[model samples]
Target chain A: AQSVTQLDSHVSVSEGTPVLLRCNYSSSYSPSLFWYVQHPNKGLQLLLKYTSAATLVKGINGFEAEFKKSETSFHLTKPSAHMSDAAEYFCVVPPNRDDKIIFGKGTRLHILP
Target chain B: EAGVAQSPRYKIIEKRQSVAFWCNPISGHATLYWYQQILGQGPKLLIQFQNNGVVDDSQLPKDRFSAERLKGVDSTLKIQPAKLEDSAVYLCASSLGLPGPETQYFGPGTRLLVL
Candidate 1:
């Protein structure tokens, strides 16, 4: 089974600061990775995905993630954080066979003004 | 394109009562999924369907939960004699179901509160 672990449960940052959400994945081989965002009382929206094509995956809202096989990490980052960026971020992994997708416990981001 | 749709954005029920939730996937999407998300926990896959056929439902508690996708487009999940643990958000998602990994679009989710 493929799974992802989010390193942080909560992260607080000042506005316009860099944001880093770490994620480590466990898989026997190359795995499909994704990032999703969920706002308060809203459905989850796909931020980005890496399907074994590119090492650097760019997502919406100026967010991006890098897939590093050596480290088994697919960490999400942003150069600058906006107030609207405060939300729950989830790291996702899907099995190679495409049976189902697994989501991490989620990292809650708080942007301070 | 319109995203997946789920009915009853919120529901309140007492223990031992029954409730049903409905979902409609994106147009022409062959794969649909249902998940249960408790507070402070990640969403757990309850069931998945590929064009009206069950692909994986090993995690679903079949004893009190039942789900059906009659025409491969609309789906429903029902809980009988609900328990307090059943209080959670039910999310519905759909994908194109191509040969490889695909992006899943999620619905607004139905929040159920079992008191």
Candidate 2:
């Protein structure tokens, strides 16, 4: 079985400041990790993924994340935040050969002016 | 290329009523998925289909919820005797079903409200 956890239920950041969203996972086998963002009343859009390729993965909207196997963490980060970045973010683990993708609860992001 | 498509962007119904949602995956994509997103939560997989066959549906509430993917193209999810907790946004997604890893493209989602 595979599971993911989003550490924060809500995160508020000032515009132009840095942002971070934390996630951790427990999987029996090597896993595929993904980050998705959802705007108000909109469906989720893929942000980035870590599939055992590179430890550091860059994504759309100038966002990026690092996969740390030792810590079992995939934390999203951005050097600067924008008002438009306010949205709900999810961390997902695609199913392995036998398991299906498992999603984290989610983190609501708020941008302060 | 067109993204996934879903119908009746929104629906409102009373508890115990039945409601159905439809989805059309991207052309040539053989994998389709249906997920439920409640307010303040991440989307949960209700079902997954590889072509016209079921791949996974362990979380689906089979007693009141049913889904089918006919002809390996379009799919529909039906909930009979719906409950208040079932109220949420239903999302449809598709992938190229390529060997290795690929991104899943999502539809706008259909929001359902049960009163």
Candidate 3:
């Protein structure tokens, strides 16, 4: 079955340090992927998406993701982490043959002051 | 543009009780989806609708859950005789149903706690 994999369950970064959240999709061919952020008791907010266009997708709040087809990865990255950036991030892919989309287990980002 | 809307942001109930969730998708969106999000896990697709018709509900627990989208607009999901494990956040999302499936806009979600 098709799936989205997010290896790290949690990541901690000191304020002003870089951040990385890895995501990999399992499929026979390339599919559009996306990143979304969720804060406590809040709805999800789209960060960025890769739809076979540019390999690098820049999103809101200074976050971005690069789609590497060869690696089957669409890892999210940010140069500097902020306190407000602490949240749960999810990687999503288009619906599979079952017409259901796949969501990675998510990676929780914690920022240290 | 207005985003998806869900009512009753929170609910608490005992096992075997019945509860329902309501969702109103963004105007002009042809597709609406319902998801179950367990703690520390990503959202799982429950059901999907396109223009008041069911597109997918393969993951839905039909024995205890039901959903419908009327007039291709507002939708409702009901769980009868809810189970303790049913406690989770329910999310509603909508898409324009464009050629590429389009981006999905999610609602604030309705959190449920089953005791």
Candidate 4:
């Protein structure tokens, strides 16, 4: 079975400050992890994906995440936060051979000026 | 490339009433998915289709929810005897096919309000 946990339900960051959203996952076998962002009234946009390629994955909109197998963590980060960066973020695990992708509860990001 | 398309951006219905949502996936994409997203939560997979065949639907409420992908192209999801808890956004997504299906493009989603 594969499952993902987003540590925070909401995160508030001041503009120009670093942003971090914590996520962890549990899987018997190796897993594929992803980070997706959703703006207001918009569909989800893929921020990054880790598929055994590299531990440090860089994605669009100056976002990045590092996959740590020992710690079982895949935390998203950015150097700075912008007002437009305020959105809902989700951590996802693709289906294993069993064929079922699991999603985290989601973290709502609030940018403070 | 054209993205996934969904109709009836918003719908308001009474409990126990039936409602339907339509979806048109990207051209040549053989995999389609339906997801339910409640407020303050991430999207949950409701069903998946591979070229007109059902792939996974374990989380769907078979008693009241059903979906069909006809001709391996467009699809529709119907909910009969809707419940208040069913109120959420129905998102339609499509991906290029298996054997390494990468990112799935999503539609705007239909927001349902059940009274």
Query: What DockQ does candidate 1 score?
Result: 0.60
TM-score of model 1 relative to the true fold? 0.94
- At residue B12, give the lDDT of candidate 1: 99
Question: Which ten-residue region of model 2 chain A has the weakest summed lDDT?
Answer: A94-103
Model 3 lDDT per residue over B1-115, tens place: 8888998899999999999999999999889999999998998889989989998899999999999998999999999989999999999999887544336778999999999
Pairs clashing within candidate 1: none
**Residue lDDT tens for model 1, B27-49:** 99999999999988888999999
What's the CA RMSD for each of the models? 1.4, 1.8, 1.8, 1.5
**Residue-by-residue lDDT tens digits, candidate 3, A1-113:** 55689989999999999999999888776787888899887888888888888999999999999989889898999999999999999988766543346777899999999
Task: Tell me the tens digit of each residue's lDDT in model 1 across A1-113.
Answer: 78899999999999999999999999988888889999987889989989899899999999999999999999999999999999999998886656466777999999999
lDDT of 2 by residue, A1-113 (tens): 77789999999999999999999988897788889899986767889888889999999999999999899999999999999999999888876643355667899999999
Every model's TM-score: 0.94, 0.92, 0.93, 0.94
lDDT of 2 by residue, B73-103 (tens): 9999999999999999999988877643345
Which TM-score values does chain B get in all models? 0.96, 0.96, 0.96, 0.96
Q: State each candidate's chain A TM-score.
A: 0.96, 0.94, 0.92, 0.94
For candidate 3, the iRMS in Å is 2.9
Order candidates by lDDT, high to low.
Answer: 1, 4, 3, 2
Can you give the DockQ of every candidate in the order shown?
Answer: 0.60, 0.50, 0.53, 0.51
What stretches of model 4 exceed 4 Å from their correct place? A97-99
Top-down DockQ ranking: 1, 3, 4, 2
Q: For model 4, what is the alpha-carbon lDDT of residue B64?
A: 100
